[model samples]
Target: MDHDIEKAPSAPPTRRDALRVAAGLLAVGAVPLAAHPAAAYPGDIDVCTGGYDAEYEADLAMAEALFEAEEHRAFAPERPPGRYTLPLRRGFRVSARYGIRGDWLAGHHTGIDLAVPTGTPVYAVSAGVVVLARRSGQYGKAVTVRMRDGHYAVFAHLSRIKVRQGARIRAGARIGSSGATGRATGPHLHLEIRARRGYGSDIDPVRYLARRGAPLL
Candidate 1:
């Protein structure tokens, strides 16, 4: 998440040297042939007047402007929203609802836990591209599908993954099998709905899928 600019070597002090030369001219009351309007000020006044190095300042200004432009360009737009289907057919009973329990060390659960036996077939909830298919940390054997609506549907604690990353899958497509792959007491499917774009909100999966015409037990 760290996004910072790398430091670059600074240019030589051409403006400071020029200002010094200009000051010597005005002190001796001798105007140099190279004297410009900026060097016409009396007694090193350019040093204190903030007009000493016009070119140097201009270069610094341009560099700073370009840096800002690059910074903005580095920030990409948020992903667009897309329609999603239920990852499983004939939803199983909800063993644990989202944000209902405080017993977990992570506080409220961000996803719904569907009670299912080990090796139970789990399908893709919607038409989306498989973004994640791996096993790690607490979400063992996880699969993340990014729908066209920019939302992501995650199925965790899977026993096996049937699809690979970057694969386009349709609704109800077999993506994995449910199991107690992560830290859990029994086999179940951990389902999550994450908002697309920069909105990292975790929505209620039951209510969300129900609105999409998917039955929820």
Candidate 2:
């Protein structure tokens, strides 16, 4: 008895076959997670749609979770208090001072500009509550801390803000780093001592800091 078996030719690969292959590769760690191009989706990716890959949908979810974790780190938690210190220690040279300036909108510069290089650590002048820590219009990445004296200490033109609003940071704590993030010609820290919490209430920050024993000279 001679029984010959003729095997059927292999069918062409479908979309599902390709997806399964990708899933298997991902599961076995053959491909790095960073290789997945999953940043396109701002929300959920519909896996119910035909030909959609489940692994890809999962990649998007992982990327979003990572983003949230990083963001949480940026906004630091509340900390204990310490003594007062100047915004800058070494690069304390004042490039601009508070007073009438024709180039300014208020016909005056509301803050003193410290000519520090980009990424210089700017510390808190005194222990206070951070009222504003976000990307302001012309100030760029700014952080305004309401000091114990009720005056606002404004740190503007920063490259990065380390504290969040309502966080009670200590005196001399690193609030942010200096940069030309706002309307500025170069890297500097725009420091303002305000009588009130508004724009037009600025006073001479150098004299103010000196009186408080945290001289910026």
Candidate 3:
């Protein structure tokens, strides 16, 4: 009674086996699998294309919003009444009102004329930067300060000019002495509050000052 055992047949190589073979071939410097075509890869982006732009736009929007907020704070909403003062320290009279017809101006008086003594110290009505401090034709030695409320405070007919263009001025700070430097019958300080930069944008100076609890005639 002799017994003989029959051996099972070996399995064929699988996909895993083929992959392993390919890897082995590659390790051994085989060019067959190494030269196989593959889909192109774009490597320029540090992050996902959509993701980077979203973050960038979010940051830019945040910055713009912050700037707008700051600009609004700097120049919007009229300041409270009593926020300004009389340009002169002592007795002065409002000889003329805004919109009064005058030959000095093109057609009207653009501001209130305060008839103060000659050489009287003139002060800035509010904290601002001087945009104009020079000799003007009719304004004489003028000084115009741009206020925080986005309005302009123009002081004209100065005997002398103190601040220059681009100078920072404080509220009630002395700018110059008042006089009838240009065409005038008497010594006075001409004050104008414009909504914008120049004469065409001129608004009422007397009412504007009176509402602010300043000295009014």
Candidate 4:
């Protein structure tokens, strides 16, 4: 007589079995694991933490370097000389003389005004040091020429400055262009002869220049 063999019965999956299957599938879908720990972290966290491999880190470093370079560039101070030439050639017509406009806020016109075109070439009246060559709210673009006589000749309302500060200049040299700058009513040069003491006293430029052989027109 022969004996019969029995087959094992299949069992249905439980909740645990289903969960294990889902996890396996998820692991497979997330393939290509990163080699670095920073890559494993969230991108935003890496950036905020200054991660070297972060996308914007290089750009930030470059910007910082550029800013530093620009800061150093301005570190070199501008050294203007102590003197400059009188920025006018021939004698200019006087439109307003210094000390005559005392009613103006400037207390008094510390300089004489020369009537000229918008961009007339202004030459150095006398040779001296360029004590000042810069812009002022009232003087506009001005140049202060210190003469050998210990007096300061101020030329105001210029369009441009040709020489740098600290550079030596001769008489009749082109220093700047005439213009209506700094509280000017029109295109004119405000000239003033200040006695080294400052604004307290100023001599009449008209008679002074005339005596110096600058004929008044």
Q: Candidate 1's residue-wise lDDT over 1-217, tens digit each?
A: 1223343555433544445544443444321222222112122110111112233223222332333343322212223333445666644656666765343332356677787777889988777666667675456677877665556787888889999865667777899999887555567888878774111256888788888777565
Query: What's the CA error at residue 37 for candidate 3, in Å?
Result: 92
What are the per-residue Cα lDDT tens digits for candidate 4 across 136-166? 5456787776554556666777888776554
Number of clashes recorded per candidate: 10, 0, 1, 22
- Candidate models: Cα lDDT each: 0.58, 0.61, 0.59, 0.51
Give the runs in model 4 whose Cα sits over 4 Å from its true position: 1-93, 104-108
At residue 111, what lDDT does model 2 achieve? 74
Best by TM-score: 2
Which is better, 1 or 2, measured by lDDT?
Answer: 2
Candidate 2 wrongly placed segments (more than 4 Å): 1-83
Q: On TM-score, who's better, 1 or 3?
A: 3
TM-score of every prediction relative to native = 0.58, 0.60, 0.59, 0.54
lDDT of 4: 0.51
Q: Model 1, which residues run further than 4 Å from truth?
A: 1-84, 103-106, 197-200
Q: How well does candidate 3 match the true structure in TM-score terms?
A: 0.59
- For candidate 3, write residues 143-164 as lDDT tens digits: 8777767788888778888786
